[model samples]
Target: MAAQLVRAAKTESKGKPERLRFYYYTAGSGGAGPTILATSFLLLGEEVVAYNKGEKIKLKPYSGMLNIDFGKGIGKRDVYLLNLPEVRSAHDVLGIPTVSARFGTAPFFWNWGMSAMTNLLSPEFLKDRTKVQQLVQLFDPLVRAVDGIAGERVSMRVDLECTDGRHTLGLFSHRKLSISVGNATAAFALAILEGSTQPGVWFPEEPEGIAIEARELLLNRATEGTINFIMNKPPWMVETDPKELGLGIYVLQFRTQVVEITDLSGGFDLALKAADCSEVYSFEDIHENRKPPQ
Candidate 1:
């Protein structure tokens, strides 16, 4: 399914409301196959994640106001989608509702690989300097905020195996989002979104994270999956410096366990696997005072 930005989310007094619509360009039969995919978006202080499968993926809501037809021709069918909170629990800490993904289901025959294509075309991955400059101009405010306070740039990276059967992984960024800030923040990356029954491990008793006082993390089984964001090296380690060369540099390195994807009537499910893709972010702290070499 081909995806494009339909509209931008408006900010609310509390935070901001995120709304996105993608269009699907279909072809061939509209049935069979249970291909699963996900999309992520950042809104206010939260992230929204949406997942969908065959014949149930919607290309309308994602179409937004922007429309395009690459002569691939569109089809009429059904679509499917699922909405989930990207940042599970951020109310207590941010004093605002976090962002979440919205989903729907329909039937259609689209490129199917559109999701991966969109990620590839995303400004972060595009090699075209003009396209990159346009993106920076469009997201100047947000980009500046992330770079200024968060100390890094925002990016989305996807890895998929179209030929071989393997689970797909999306590494939005290597910086650990603040376990405290919620939503994907350029600042305070998620060093370790982990959990353990052991004391001093820093966690709450909720399925996700607990809410109270200064805010303790609950970290349930599902939330435990968040650990996939962390790397083996120290979270704050200055592994490399790209600023000296006068370029914005960020790298996301991750390692993953092989999780073969199988399709059944019940849907695509697999053994939870891990891949190491941790990252390092280098940016000049605008707030730091400069000291000449002595």
Candidate 2:
């Protein structure tokens, strides 16, 4: 199937894209019983992967399984930093020079049966038709609620908030996170495939053309809800929260939209560039368990 996609991608124009300060945020749905059951591997113990100057580096992650009070939209659920195998192949195998690669998700606070469900749910294990029916009955609400979830509406969003020098805090480009759009990675993937001129197969690992197109898709994408405040600038410039963000990190929050954002900072106090995270993370020398994105 992957080979078929590669053949399909050959017709399109290939490119070298540098999408730094990337992040994935989720909200609204996805914390239900069915959703958690589907995406367990991505959430558990996965670290966000970044490729810079041909080095595959691991970024920081949130502590334990649940956020005590820090999670923005997930509400005491799980938001995990991820390392997609395809992204790794893009750099390691394809040798596509990558500025960055990242992904994250805020699953609607974990469902009650999250841990156990992950351990179970197999075709071989649950062979009986009775089990399948019972399982569907349990997650019927979640399945019915999501058609599933927003399509173009974007319940899951990927932010390519890269600057000449860029950094990230956990899943967001900014240290003090806020609510944004969610889910449309499926649409994004389909766009790449449907955009294909000739019939062939493709995998998640991007060819040059697919990588370039993916970067273009991520640019200036607005979420479904309307908002006045935006975080398009480099993390430090946007005055969001005035509290303990990052070194020189400014903040602003938008709850689903630009409503009651916590630590919403309007202006900034002029200060020297004492010590910034993006400055350090922007470089390539800090790999191999060295000082990384914090």
Candidate 3:
């Protein structure tokens, strides 16, 4: 079937303003695609491919996915991030609440699943003042309880007395070290931890567009690919106020190395000027050896 522009926005510039258009599509091979059944809610919701509540959609026909075009004027911060269920419901459903309500803090001190379920079943278990006080007292005495247990087994303890008490230490008194690592692996780890966050290594700057494609990929499990797009800036902005124009690179490292990039048609254009550019001479370029095919 043909692609549908499910959401579209067009804004013109007296000056520049961001505009975005979102589209979704599906395709199937050999035979016609599965039928989409529409559903309606009390208030009109965003259009969704209609499917019966309990109907199962086959894996093959639903493969063709969406393409998000965050128009030229969009900013990185302006992007709205949503999970699949939230995106499917068009943000009507609040799937998961914050950790503070379910657990006790922003970075939860307990297992998320257990704490979330506990709060889901009994709402006030973490929220109520009395319950929190009781938990604090119970956890307060856990230190002493652990100290009294004498055994040859391994033990771990959290002392909540530090000024910034969130710090944790792993102790392994009877541990043995036999893990093998070469020199290259050791140096790479050091470089990533020490070098990347420093100014000389990498620069952090504001990005140009709303990267909704990555968010969509996260939500819908889109296939592996590198997405690129161009943003056309006004002549005045490009020539006079380059920094104010705020053009920079934002690299999204793969969870796993992208074995291949499926499409590169949407790539953004960059106008590099010699005035602000630096040149470097490389002493050596690193190369990898590929294994021969069987």
Order of the predicted models by lDDT, top scorer first? 2, 1, 3
Give the best candidate by lDDT: 2
Candidate 3 matches the true fold with a TM-score of: 0.18
TM-scores for candidates 1 onward, in order = 0.19, 0.39, 0.18
Looking at model 3, report the run of 10 residues with the lowest lDDT sum.
Answer: 97-106
The residue ranges of model 1 lying beyond 4 angstroms of the native Cα positions read: 1-60, 64-210, 213-217, 220-222, 225-227, 230-294
How well is each residue in 203-292 modelled by candidate 2, as lDDT tens digits? 444443344455334423322232222333222322223233555343323222121112223322222122221223211221121233
Candidate 1 residue-wise lDDT, 73-133, digit = tens: 1212232222333223212222223222222222221323333334445424443545544
Candidate 1's displacement at residue 64, Å, is 4.4
lDDT of 3 at 197: 29
Q: Which stretches of candidate 3 lie over 4 Å from their true place?
A: 1-109, 112-121, 140-257, 260-294
By summed lDDT, the worst window of 10 consecutive residues in model 2 runs over 281-290
lDDT of 3 at 35: 12
Q: Which one wins by lDDT: 1 or 2?
A: 2
